[model samples]
Target: MKQKDTGVMLLFVTTLTVIIWLWAAGQTKTEATVTTTVRFKAPEGMTSTVTPSFASVTLTLAGPRSAVNTAKAACANGLDLTVAETDGTVSINDIASRLNALDELKTSGATTVSAEPSAFNVDIQTMVQVEAAVEAVLSNVTVSGDVTVNPATVTLSIPKRIRATLPDAITVQAVVSDSALQQLSPGVVHTRDAAIRLPIPLDVPDVTVSPSRVEVTFKIQSMKEETVIPQVRIILAGPPEDYASYTVELPRKTISNVTVEGDIDIIDGIKSGEYAVFAVIRLASRDMEQLISSKPVTSFLAIGKDGAGHQLDVSVENPDALNVELNIAPVSGAE
Candidate 1:
């Protein structure tokens, strides 16, 4: 019986010591250091700007061990502050009090002792929603006609300060991806969804557009081919009065090996002479007057119309060299 009683007494003493230690540990004063993120937001019809945009703050909290642990856990998730004032600075001194006042910290009996980052600047501006036109931007393809964008206009939520600096009219771009353009088939309407983007200088934060994606519709032409036309005839043309007053002479009546590129059918027509490729030197009264100085005059060549009086769609190669040398003098028996 004595041995059993001693064993029970020893177990009781050990259990009491552990309970006391646990209670003391729970009530012990402690300090915890933690790093947390800080975010700021504005009310409706308002926009806010922070200097760093993203902020991480370190804080030292003081309280009982349990309370400090609770505060530390809350700090890990960071804090969000609402800006009521239109513009002001957020000082570090203000952050500690705000942290202590947080419900998690307050209820847990934790106090913020200190914080890193002595200060941060914040500015708030009013926001206005305005309608802006959206344009489709395409590349690596030739559009047959005007590109159509569905919901041609979108609402833009722009800050008042930014709006003040912008022009009365605003346009956003719906840029089509290059991959989509490459996959487009020729001679058919292709519909695609492109994300809208603000023009340069306006592509900043706090500017958002409703219906971020717009449908763009366009038709593209087939891949083009290049061909050369040999010995295209060059002609001299002028106003009647200028022609009557001056005799114009051409040094070269034909250009050789003129390269042109366009649709395959158009290229074939040009090569087979079904469509004529010619250059014309046009002279005005001013040109005739300049010729009187007896100096050789240079004139740029203009592409001639086809038999149907329609301009050809082919692009001339080395356009800068498509010129003629003109020699002019007074017509015989004329002043």
Candidate 2:
């Protein structure tokens, strides 16, 4: 009877210890579920040709308390996506499975993981490089100095499908900010690095631009104006065949002392004859009789030539001289 009692007590103690161990294990490793987001990262050298339907996915991780928490934190950090070489498809289930396999989320820890979208597909393309010209966007505000841009061009990676839509010329632009005007020093050149903008239309898609910035150099100077009187002359505008035998002249009295306005330095040059400024009267054989019989022919300023070939912007101040008298004479030796 004593032996029997001792054996029964020992068995009862063992059974109680086993129940306590099981209860403690259940308390520490409770089953739990967590909801989190999985962010996708693009692989190198590969870019999406089309916008993805979704940017991220919601995940429900089910496992032990510690394991579920670990996965919840990992998912919070996002996941590096991998695409299948065969079809470039990403399997959401596979990603979840991989997450569940993580050592932190041991099989004993995490029972399973689920993703909202079971799977999805992406369109990828290889980048093609093309060189495009750079256009300058400047405000109408006058610049006192010469303006220039370094690297007047840019290189872009264009999607092959959209390449044909690109015109024979592709262009980017660099804008000169109004703020730049405040930094200008008269007669002094100033340079600043500016951002280059791609003016791709909405229709054109998937393009990457390189060297997105360019150096812009310009000068600022005070504009000066002045007035002067310069001599005027007329040259027939019709074909030489029609005027070969005709000599054209203007009555000196009609055009003498005509007032002119332009850049001070340029006007001074014109007064000194360093640059030529003149006017022309239109004469055509079709209207020759009407012109000779009609009143003074109308004359307008024409580009006058200097040995240096610089353009002059001089204009006549007197409204009357805009019309002039034409004395036409036949050359002595003409057919």
Candidate 3:
């Protein structure tokens, strides 16, 4: 009986000591520095801007060990702040005070000694939805007619401050995909849905379009036709004073096997002589002065149209061959 009683007393004493140690540990004061994210949310019908959308804040907390740990965990998760003001800056101290009052920190009994980044700015603006015109943008193909968009306009939700800075009318782009461009051919209308994009200076996070995609319809035209012009005349032209004083001569008066590439109609006109191609050696006063030395000068031959007067949108093949030598001499007895 005595032995059993002694064993019971020893067990009781050990249990009491363990309880006291645990209680003391719980009451121990501690400090911890934790890095956490500070997130700002705007009120309804509004938007906010910050230099870095994901801002990290370091906090120094002091309290009981358990409370400090709990608060640190809470802060690491994140602190969300609702910004009520439409425009202005929120100081770091103001933000820290608000954080200390939060339920998580209050319940944990942790005091925030300091928060780093000492300051930050917030730009809040009211949001407004407006109608913006939509247009189609295509590439790597020749479009014959005006590109048409089905909806013609999209609803844009943008910040009021940005809208105030913008022009009265806003236009968005619906870009066609590269795969669709590869399959497009001439002489037929093509239709495809393209995603809308805002023009630069307005393309920002605060601006959003309701309809993400729009249908674009357009027709492709045959873009390339190659033809050989049998003969192209070469003429020497200059300023009136230079022409009167200097006579220019070319070894070859005309060039043959001149290949050109352009629209089918334009190429046909060139082949049928309805359009004329001439290589002109345009002389300036400088050229007249240089020719006075009697040395042959090389000049670029510029392709020109005849008096018929039509826009020449043609690419000449081997343009380097068109560069010629101009042998110029002063006219007899004319200074």
Candidate 4:
């Protein structure tokens, strides 16, 4: 009797297992998500404020078999979130786009509103090592003394080594000519002659200081009263470079109110004749049918003033002489 009971129980268990397996055969389980992403905007301007700087965001997904499979490829493409656009001037649209793209990748589970990229932060405080160019003007400033530079405007790029030491804001040491040191203004005139100082922030690289410091040449400007050489003249009118028999002269001594505008330094130039009279020559075209047709020769100082108070390239020994092989257009005899 006991054996019969045991056999019957085993047959009942077998029947239950077969029934359960048969009922569940064809249905497919819903698919689950793999990943998800969070995207932020790329801000514009100064870049001082933009953070984290993430490019593509990822997301994990789960859903119906087809939807979950689709999520795999979509998530790979990444989410689009855009940085808010306030003013038309900024380039933060990338961020704005990325932020919006996240949703398309995977459906936000009805259970959770957030997407992937669990936690993120943008650090604006990472001591941005940057290089700044400082433009200094020597406007009314003058050299302290007799020093001179080839170009008044010093072009300098801060070296990476030195730039590494500079602060957010940079201040260059004052520049004063050694010769004119005594004549400088009561206060410190730290910068002069369009002198430029590069801001060498801490830990920068691959830069150079132009001229090291400005070249202190002999002299370029003066601070004395402006003086005019009453009889000194500029004689630069003659023939073109091709003309050999061109003769230029200021038959009458050349004198104009010597206008020294900058400072006494320029006045000194007037007295020294280092900056002497510049002569200009102009030839009007014989074709005066209209001022528009033949433009008058522009006023150019073909000859710069020299030390001897005369036109360029001419000396007292040689006098004013040039060979100008030129022919003026003959006057019109047309009807």
* lDDT values for all models: 0.72, 0.59, 0.73, 0.39
Candidates 3 and 4: which is better by TM-score?
3
TM-score of each: 0.66, 0.49, 0.60, 0.24
Residue 153's C-alpha lDDT in candidate 2?
84
For residues 261-320, write the lDDT of model 3, one tens digit per residue: 555566677767566666555667997878732222223222326554333333345555
Q: Write the per-residue lDDT of candidate 4 for residues 108-153, one digit (tens) a residue.
A: 3212223444444443321233333333323334345444343444
Residue 103 of model 4, lDDT score: 62
Clashing pairs in 2: 144-221, 145-219
Candidate 1, position 187, lDDT: 88
Residue 148 lDDT (model 3): 90
Clashing pairs in 1: none
Collision count of model 2: 2
Model 1 score (lDDT): 0.72
lDDT for each residue of candidate 1 in 98-175, tens digit (9 for 90 to 100): 667767778877888887874566655667888999989885456898789998999998877778988999999999
lDDT of 3 at 146: 85
Cα lDDT of candidate 2 equals 0.59
Q: Please rank every candidate by TM-score, starting with the best.
A: 1, 3, 2, 4
Q: List candidate 2 stretches off by more than 4 Å.
A: 1-31, 47-50, 53-56, 84-113, 119-126, 129-148, 151-157, 167-170, 178-186, 199-210, 220-335
Superposed by TM-score, candidate 1 places the C-alpha of residue 16 at a distance from the truth, in angstroms, of 8.4
